[model samples]
Target: MRTLDSLILDQISGGADAGSLTTADTILVCDDPTGDLTAAACGSGRRVVVLDSDYSRCQRAISLGAQIAGDRRLDEFLAGSNGSAVAVGEMPKSLSRLDYLARSIAGAGFDTVTCVFGANNKHLARSMNETLATSFEEVSASRGRGKFRCLVATGPRNVTYEPAAGDGLVAVGGVFSGARADHGGELLRSALPAQLGRFLDLGCGNGSVSRGLDGDITATDSDADAVLSARAIGLSTTWDDAGSRFPAGTFDTIALNPPFHAGTTVDATLVSSLLDASARLLAPGGCLYLVHNSHLRYRPEVERRLGSVEQVARNQRYTVLRATAR
Candidate 1:
């Protein structure tokens, strides 16, 4: 178990000992990437349900002896729990995601519910408590242990989800750029050719890069939240990792704004793997438009994987490169 997971379990056990959490209540483990909490909760002879957006994580939870709610949406799961569910998980890094989670839990028609979310101290913020307070009547922080602490929220208040309006981009929380155009995505979009055939928006976050584009466009992302956001805006989307599900030479044009971070850790290999995937997926003589931070220096990698590379656009923060498959 991760250190943060241990801390969260300690907090949950403390709550149960204090009579706030009962075994009769179903424990909803939300987005537990490690599956430790889900397994532990099930082992304690408690009714446990897992609420995770990622299909892979849900499978892990199931293997750990936890039941999954249909569709994996928090609201639907809590509604069936009959007001006797307590949620536990690691707090999301995105404040918008945290707020969305708190609201969904609070609005499940439950008169009362408790949520325990833990994370490293560096990841936790005062705004998290404020965000939870918007949905729950009470929000408090636990004492720090091993550089980790859990946020506790109780007394669910009546709240409803209000989708953000304007900008035509409909993104759920945790999706990159969140209902707005990311600067890197905008750069790649502008660099795209006016005419495209069999276009693929690789790593499409919220489908922003494919918006307003002509021809047969398909968007794909590894993150379930991102796929949901992209589909919300009427784009054809697939939840895939690095275009791995598609056959080679499937796309004539590919647009990529690959993610550089995997949960607070900057991993340059993610970009490299995406570059390789894009190269393999592009048809011979097809073009790829990729945007990244100016400092990543990906031109050589693109040239080695694809063919000749050209700088299409560049600003202080980002560089857009175009490479045609050989």
Candidate 2:
């Protein structure tokens, strides 16, 4: 929780200490990427569960000693709860989660739900308000501090998720930046080796790389939304942190369009992790088809992992590289 997050506890959750837990209480904390506030809300006698899209975030929840489902969605997790649930959540930045959260709360048989939010994201604020209007009979808000706000709602109403369009891509409530084209991804897909056999789509989003590709294509992503979207398209999908889900030397080739950001901060190290993972996952003589911003200087680093990294294709914004595992 940042200072704004602290405001959430102070204003919405009564400083995170007002509730008395019972064995019968089922508490859900949603989108708990950091796990700090969610862990604090997990009292002694109640069952608490967390929902997070990111594998690292879910791992953080486990490390903080909170239980979460393998599916990590609210509806999926709450279906198993024996009693009615109460929930506290951070505001979602996208319409996907907001829509899903509303439907899930209704499906979960929740008695009450509150979301702590900052108005910095107008789209999120609007979606949250819309979801609340449809999902709850009574909804109220707390006074704001700086850009922060809170909404308390009860009673359930029906909600339908966003519709499919264009490529029939339906992002599963957790895809970052939505299920759209990534120039790097498109470039990498175009530049894939024609001799492909068993392959992995690392950081797969909506199976964009594996779609229409021949052979045994396995797709993996850290985002639950991306895996769900990939699976929706009939791809064999796995939730992964980098390429750790598979054994060493598992694939004949890998397609990587490495992410450079975690949250909003740009971090160049993500490409290194992807390259290392690609190396570990590729058999000898296997190939890595990688794409990134043209100025990223990934060649030197990529060469360190797989030998003879060659320049494949380059445009004004992107550069594609091919690496052969030694």
Candidate 3:
């Protein structure tokens, strides 16, 4: 039931020093889906470099004017420890990335270490606290802010980050992790058929729909962070869609709410590929179900491939499309 504004309000607030942020060069260590923070920061006149695990997030970051921070490798970023403060709207998953970042910082040096993890990232916080307690200067946590948490670790000190601002942006529950499923889940549940043999939710952000499906289903996205985030909640079987590779005609049903924006602009490539992939993945007589903004030009592409496409339903802002595999 949360609108975009409501979710954004409940999840993200003003970052630190909106003005004081040195316009100097900065590198953001984040996954692809969350790389928007790097782009936004870069727009503030800072020479930004983005380090991501997935190539897509890196490409999007550079497209937004962020310099390539040395390909999307965790070790690459962690090895040098630019010591410059990094920023994110939310935290990445627990893995060598956190450990590497901490080690790099300890070696390279930094003044302030500010981490904004999604409120839903308790496991991530726990992991960092358990593994890097002595490495960071200070470590602090806050709650109920959805998928965003602001942690400030000062010279090996553990301190909890306080709420920056409250306009209902801060949720009641402390930091929580999972896909931001509030609105997308409802849309998928409403648009999809009740009975399906096999399902594939493309760009399955947090696996919101795949998790709800009754039978066999596969969830996928180009964003590893999204796939990782969804899988952390038990929705597995994600593939990197960068190369657009998948077993042909392997799915009986496919669904998506496809992302509209990657970095800062409307990306038609993602939509175009989703359609092509749907056509390639669906078996004969299989169905492709999708929801997208009403204004996007998806009909022509759908018809081009499927030879038949129809609008199942529509509202002022969104449209649901259905097509059968030939």
Candidate 4:
């Protein structure tokens, strides 16, 4: 049998390394297990914690003929053995693997945790490292397999993540200290109306939006993993395909940081659909707040659907739009 390093490196073009493998390490891996790197990492004998946002992937890992471990079953399996674990498919789709991994450790009561993502999840890696650096003793980054790697070490000492000045959205309460909205919790705190009664937080990553709200707020996401994350954070959430069945006129407020891509491809259909959904879901006089990268062409859709849209705030890279339901 081939060593894990050789196998991973060969497939990822020397991007994989065994040197980072440390002893007794509880590493969180949020990657496609079908991918070679995960297999290599698993073979290396590290205490692998598998986390995939996809329910299918989670189910596959738990079945009899599985190759990867489950996320939810990790604590049970890791009770005595030094072998790897799969966290099952309980992670949220809105959260990148890193966020899912962080929330997993926070909930699982692990002293320290590290995360590794494939090239496809680089954006997630960056956000994770930047936001959750202090929670883990060490927050490190590496490049491999056309992806980025994030390693975080956690312990009793509380670490915090802060988005830099001018980043627009700020980190809010209960985010860094193992709260439901640690990563983008502030997005919820900011976008949510103070007197929110029935609302919807679209693309609620890690359930921050729902957690920030006082009463019932419907959380929705196309990513099953994200929906799971919202639920994990105790948010009443719904998962949909973005093609059918969104709660219509069932909310007073709607919010989103719409996704920019679909599996690394520039797919705007999700965002466009969100705009339409927001308009349809909001009661008359209801409001929709959206934060997005400045360059994305969302204004047209928002205007077409809502009759009018206004910019609430603007920065170099991001814009916050608040549109009213006519």
Q: What clash count goes with each model?
A: 0, 0, 29, 23
Report how far off residue 48 is in candidate 1 (Å).
Answer: 4.0
Better of 2 and 3 by lDDT: 2
Better of 3 and 4 by lDDT: 3
User: What CA RMSD would you report for each candidate?
Assistant: 2.9, 3.2, 11.9, 9.2
lDDT ranking, high to low: 1, 2, 3, 4
- The candidate that wins on TM-score is 1
Off by over 4 Å in 1: 15-24, 42-47, 65-80, 110-112
Q: Provide the overall lDDT of each model, using Cα atoms, as 2-decimal numbers.
A: 0.81, 0.71, 0.56, 0.51
Error of 4 at 135 (Å): 21
Per residue, candidate 4 scores C-alpha lDDT tens digits across 44-101 of: 5655554444445544444423343332332233333333222211112233334434
lDDT of 1 by residue, 209-231 (tens): 89877789898887767877788
**Candidate 1 pairs with clashing backbones:** none
**TM-score of structure candidate 2:** 0.85
Identify the superior model by TM-score, candidate 1 or candidate 3. Answer: 1
lDDT, model 4, position 197: 65
Sort the candidates on TM-score, descending order. Answer: 1, 2, 3, 4
Query: What digit string (tens of lDDT, one per residue) describes model 3 on residues 1-326?
Result: 22222222232334535553442245444543545466556656655656554546666776787765432223334444444554443443543445544444454444454443343443454666654565565566654445544444445332222221232122111112232454544565578888877788877755566664678877777654455545555665454672255688888888877777654468866678778788888889998887877888888888888866888867777788889889
